[model samples]
Target: MPKYIVEGGFNFYEELYKSLDDELVDTPIPDDTQNSTNDFNNVCLISNLPLTDKFVTLECKHKFNYMPLYNDLVNHKKKYNTMERKTLKCTEIRCPYCRNIQNKLLPYYDDIEISKVHGVNHISETTLIMNQFDNVSCKSYIAGTCSHEYMCSDGTTMPCTNSMVTLLCNKYYCANHKYFGKMAILKEIKIKEKLELHAKILEAKKKILEEKKKTKLAAKMVKDLAKEEAKKVKACAKAAKVTTHAENIENVIISTQSGCVQLLTTGKNKGKSCSCAKIYQNNLCLRHHNLINKNKPYDGTGTNYGNPEQAGLWVQWVNGQEPEPDTDPDPEPK
Candidate 1:
C-alpha cells in the first residue's frame, strides 16, 4: 500500500464513532440488513487506521556567530575601494531575533567562482560552512535568519553572479518567528533606553549631593540648641557615690511605668526583664519569622496533564502525540 490514502463520505465515520461509545446499541438488527447496501464498511477498515499525530523537533544551533552586516561595509561600497566582508561564519548562536537556527545556508558568493578568481575555493565558503553544522530539517521548515536579498532577477530564476548566500535553520515552520523577531528588536531598543537612563541618574545624583549638604547644616543648628537645654537640666541633679567596701548586692526587681514591662530578678541577664520575654530566639521578629519556609506545592503536573494546549508547559502539546518525557520523568533534567 502507498504510505498515505484518503477515504470519502461523511457518514463513513459513523461506525467509528459508534465503536467508541459504550451506550451504542443495535439489539434490533434489521431483517434485510444485507440488502440495504448503505451501511458504513469500506470507510473504516482495520487497514484504514488513522495515523497517530506526530511531531518532530529540530535541533538547530547558531550558524553565523556574528551578524553579516558590519559598520564599515557601507563606506567601502561607496568608495568602490573597500568591499564589505561577509561576517556570518559558522558558530553556536541563535538568530538573535528568532531564537532559531537556519534550515538552508547560502554562501556569500559562489565557492567555485571565488576559488577560480582567487586561486582558492575553501577559504571563504569552508569557513562559513563550518559554523552551521547543527542545522536540522524536519517535515515543515522555513528561513528568515538572513538579511540577504536576490538582485538582478527576472520572472524566472534569480541571477547568481553576485548573489550573497543566505542563512536558514533546520526549522521549517516560520510562524513562530514573526513574534520572536519583534522581541529581539525590542531588546535592542531597551539597550538604547538603558544608556539614556544612566546619564539621567548621574545628573540627579549631582543635584542630590548639593541638597544633602544644605540639610546637614540645617540639622546641626537644631541639635546645638537641644544640647544647651540638656546642660541646664544636668546642673540641678547630683551624682551618688559608690564605696569600695560595700558588700555584693542582691537581685532587685524594678517595674516600669508601662504596665507591660517589669524587671527579672534571676537567671540569664538577671534583673534584666520578666515582662519583655521574647516569643522566639531567632533574629527575625515574632511577626515575620518562620521555623520553616513552607513551599506551596505545584498541585498539578499541569492543569490539563494529558492535554498539550491546556498544559502549556511543553512544545509537545502543539501536536497531539503527547511525548513520553511529559508523561514520565526525563533521563536528564537540566
Candidate 2:
C-alpha cells in the first residue's frame, strides 16, 4: 500500500473522503483504457477532489483550488472510467452538478476509438435528428380539418385543427384565409381599394348633380325673365295700338267737320253755335252732332241730365238763336 498525504491532514481527509465517496457513487463514467485515467483525473479535479491516492494515481501535476482525499479521488476516477466504457458514441457530456455543457475544463471523450485518435469529434459539431411525421396529410390541412400538433422552435404549441397550412420550398406556414393568408391579404387590399374608388365615384356624382341643378335653376330663371319681358313688350304694343286708333278717330272727326259752322245743343256749350267750317246731318257741325246725339234722352225717359244750366242752354239752342247774356232786365217794381 502506498501512503498518501492530504493537504488538510488525516482528520480533514476522513471527513472529505466520506462525503466525496457518497457523491461519486452516483456519478457515471466513460470507457477506453488509453485515456481513461487521464479523463478520470480531470473529473476528480473538477469535483474539487485531490488527484493523488495511497494506491495508484496519475503522474500529471495539476494545481487545484481545494484539496481532496486521495481515496475519494481514486473512487471517482473509477466511476468515470466505467461510465465512459458503457456510454455510446456521440453522446453529450454535461456537468453533473450544474447540468450545463462541460466545455471549459473537461475534454471531449467518446466510446469511438477512431474519434479519440483523430481528436476531431466536438460537442459543437453535434447534430440532433428530428422525428418525422409519416401519416400527416397536406390536403387535410388545407381543408381546415388537420389533427396535427405543430410545434415551433421557441417552445410554442399550436393545434392544426380548423387551421390552414401552406407548404413552400420545404417551409411550413399557418394560413388564415379570413385575414392573414397571402391571398386573403391581397383580397382585403383589393376590397379597400374598391371601396375608396366607389366613395370617390359617389362624390363625383354628387358634384355633377349639384352642378346640373345649378344649371337647371339658372335656365329656369332665364326663361321666367324672358317670359316677363315678352309680356311687357306685348302690353306696350297693345297700348300703342290703342293710342293710334284713338288718334285716327280724332283725325276722321276733324276731317268730317272741316268747314262746318253750326249751333251746338248739349253739354257745357249747348246754347253756342258751332264754329266749324264743315257741316253734316241736321245742319250741325260733326262735333255738335256727335255731342247732341250723346246727350239725347232715351225713349220716354225723363230729361234730367244732372245740370239745369246745361238743359237751359239746350232749350235756347233749339230755338235757333243765341241766348242773351245775363243782365238785369229792368228795375223791378219797387
Candidate 3:
C-alpha cells in the first residue's frame, strides 16, 4: 500500500481542502436565465443601475452601463485564462442579458437633459410668432405638458395637460376634458382619411395588376412569334435536304449506281471498305476524298457537286446510229 504524501503538515492538506470547498460554495454556476427579469426601466443588467453612458450589444440589443460591461468582460477573460470551466465564459464576450456572443457594441445616447431641452418648447421661431399673433398660447409651454385650455363636453372650461393635438381641428385637450362633438368630428375626419388612403392603395394595386397582365400578354406574344419562327426554320430545313454534309452526299449519290471503294477509317466500320455511292472526282467517296486531298469544304460545299463521268459503275452504251429495218421474210415466217 502506498501512502499519500502531504506537504507542510497534516493541517496543510486540511486547509487546502477547506479552501477548495469554500470556493466551490461561494461561486455559483451560471444560469442561462440569470439576467432574465421584468426590470426593464432603462437599467443595466450587470450592475442593476440606471444605464449611464450606455453601450448596447449589437446582437442582443441589451443596454448596459459602459464601465460595468467592460469590467465584466475583463473578469470573464481572466477566468477563462485561469482554466475556470464554467458555462457562459465571459472571454467570448457575451451579452449580459441574452448571453449571446457579442463582438461589438454600439453607443446609444439617450441624454435626459437634451431630451428635456428639445421637448414641447422646441417649435420653430416662425411658428411661435404665428401663435403669438393668433392670441393663442403655443400649446406646448413645457416638457410633457400642454398649455391649451378649452371647453369640455360638459360646458365647463378646463386646462388641458395632454401633449396630443388633433390633426383635423388642431385642438389640444386631455382625455378627461375632450368634447363629444369634437371627438365625433375627429372620428369622421379619420374615417375619411382612411377611406382616401384605401382608395389610393386599391388604385395602385389595380395598376400593378394591369402591368402584370400586359407583361404576361407580351410574353405570350413573344412565345407565339418564336414558335412561328421555329416552324418556318423547320420547313426551310426540310425543303433544303442537302444543307448538311451527310445530306449533300446522299443527294449526289441518289442517281449513282455503285459506291466508292474507299476503306472506313473510324467507328464500328473501321478498316472496312466504304459503301457510300457518292463518288467524288478522285474515284473516292466524298469523306475519303476530302481526307486524302485535305480539302475542308465550308458546311459541305464541295461534297454535293462532282463529276458523274468519273463513276466506276457508269458505262456508256455504244449502239449504232440507225437500226436495221424488219425484213419481209421474218413476217412470212411469223
Winning candidate number (lDDT):
3
TM-score of 1: 0.15
Candidates in descending lDDT order:
3, 2, 1
The parts of candidate 1 lying over 4 Å away from their true place are 1-186, 202-206, 225-334
Better of 2 and 3 by TM-score: 2
Q: Which of the predicted structures, 1 or 2, would earn the higher lDDT when compared with the native? A: 2
Candidate 1 lDDT over residue span 1-334, tens digit each: 3343336634545666887564447455468766533332222121232222221112442222111311122222224433324333233212332345433222233322322211111233332323332242343233333332234546453422322223333212133332333344456557877898999899899899989988998899888878877766664442211222122121122222222133334456455333323433232222122212112112355432233333443454345444343232211111
Off by over 4 Å in 3: 1-178, 242-334
lDDT of 2 at 3: 62
TM-score of 3: 0.25
- The segments of candidate 2 whose C-alpha lies over 4 angstroms from its true place after superposition are 1-180, 259-334
Which candidate, 1 or 3, has the higher lDDT? Answer: 3
255 in model 3: Cα distance from truth in Å? 5.1
What lDDT does model 2 reach?
A: 0.48
Residue range 1-334, candidate 2, lDDT tens digits: 5567766455676688999998899777656786866665554545455444321222234433222322232334324564444332333333333333322222333432322211112332112111112223456355333333567899997666555654422334444322233343356557987999999999999999999999999999999999999999999999999999999998897666544445445456555545554554555554445445545542233233324544565576676757555453322111
Worst 10 residues of 1 by lDDT: 113-122
Model 2: ten consecutive residues of lowest lDDT: 124-133
